[model samples]
Target chain A: MEKSSVLTVLSALAHDTRLDVFRLLVRAGPEGMTAGSLAATLDIRSNTLSNNLVILSAAGLVRSAREGRAIRYFARMEQMRDLLGFLMEDCCGGQPELCQPVLDQITCPC
Target chain B: MEKSSVLTVLSALAHDTRLDVFRLLVRAGPEGMTAGSLAATLDIRSNTLSNNLVILSAAGLVRSAREGRAIRYFARMEQMRDLLGFLMEDCCGGQPELCQPVLDQITCPC
Candidate 1:
């Protein structure tokens, strides 16, 4: 990923609301959740949620699909990988010991 | 890590100069690099670099030590793990396939 795109993803996740939104979506799994459900779960106003959803979608952290009358959002796991890869690229300059611990722990319990 | 600290780290890295500095330090490995060398490497002014370093340090992304007349900075690899862990905690809701690809790829080529 490009630097600007990395920055955009970082900026999008840097916020309290958007971060909550993305994480919640990630936990929600592949079926995902609707904007209404997200706002209610996070307890934020709809317009506020709407604004953050737009920002997250633009940053490529969240993807949405039309379902019936509402739109559902899912975490873009690939973008998450891209962001992590961008940061970890060239990491430690051949010193695997410095970062291998991170890799070992990265395998989630789930 | 707490959400606030996560936000701080995300915000600190969201900038161009600081991201460059941290990645350079990461590539530089445990020996790290001096602010002067970093400024020359990234081609930014000393004060500007100073400002970003302060921010990165405050965010717990970078650590510094006094080396005679110069201060050297190292990327806090553990903090990187903390940030990544926070994001991946409860990730996929028991769906390993959703995040395992990232884990497999996370092992640095080095």
Candidate 2:
């Protein structure tokens, strides 16, 4: 992925509220969450949540789908994987072991 | 890890020079590189690199040690691990599968 694109993703998640939103959506799995539900869960104003979601969407970190009358947002795992690949590639070219610790910690049973 | 700390690290890496510095240090391994060497490699000025290094250091993304008159910087993999752990915990509680694709891609032979 492009460095600018990676930067955008990083910047998008740098905020406290957006990071919370992204994690919550990730945990929500493919079911996602409607804007109203997300606002209620995070206890933020709809305008604040909307602003963050727009930034997240612009960064390709989150995507939304319309179901009935509400739009639900889902985390874009592919973009995150791409971000990790870009960072890992930096070390893999020289010392793949440099990323061994990080890769090990991120390994999940599921 | 604290959400604020995570945000700090993410913000530190959101910049072009700082991210370059961190990734280069990661690839450089424990030996790391001096500010001058890093500046030369990235083709930026000493002051620019120094400013970025300060932020990375403050964010616990990198550490510096004096070597003679110069100092070398190393990427703090532990902090990266913590960041990953915090993010993983987000999904592990509800859907560990959310992070599976990312983990699968990052799995290395080493």
Number of the top-ranking candidate, with lDDT as the measure: 1
Error of 1 at B65 (Å): 0.9
Clashing pairs in 2: none
> After TM-score superposition, what is the CA distance of residue A83 in candidate 2 from its true location, in Å?
1.5
Scoring each candidate complex against the real one, what DockQ results?
0.47, 0.43
Q: Report the lDDT tens digits of candidate 2 across residue range B1-110.
A: 89999999999999988988898887887678999999999999999889999999999988999999999988886777667666666564486566656544444332
TM-scores of all candidate predictions against the true structure: 0.87, 0.85
Local accuracy by lDDT, each model: 0.84, 0.81
Residue range B28-102, candidate 1, lDDT tens digits: 888899999999999999999999999999999899999999999999877776687678766786565666565
Q: On a 0 to 100 scale, what is the lDDT of residue A8 in model 1?
A: 96
Poorest 10 consecutive residues by lDDT, candidate 2 chain A: A101-110
State the lDDT of candidate 2 residue by residue for A19-83, as single tens digits.
99999987886678899899999999999999999999999988999888988998886777667
Itemize residue pairs with steric clashes in candidate 1.
Answer: none
Error of 1 at B89 (Å): 1.1
Q: How well is candidate 1 docked (DockQ)?
A: 0.47
Question: Each model's interface RMSD (Å)?
Answer: 5.0, 5.3
DockQ of predicted model 2: 0.43
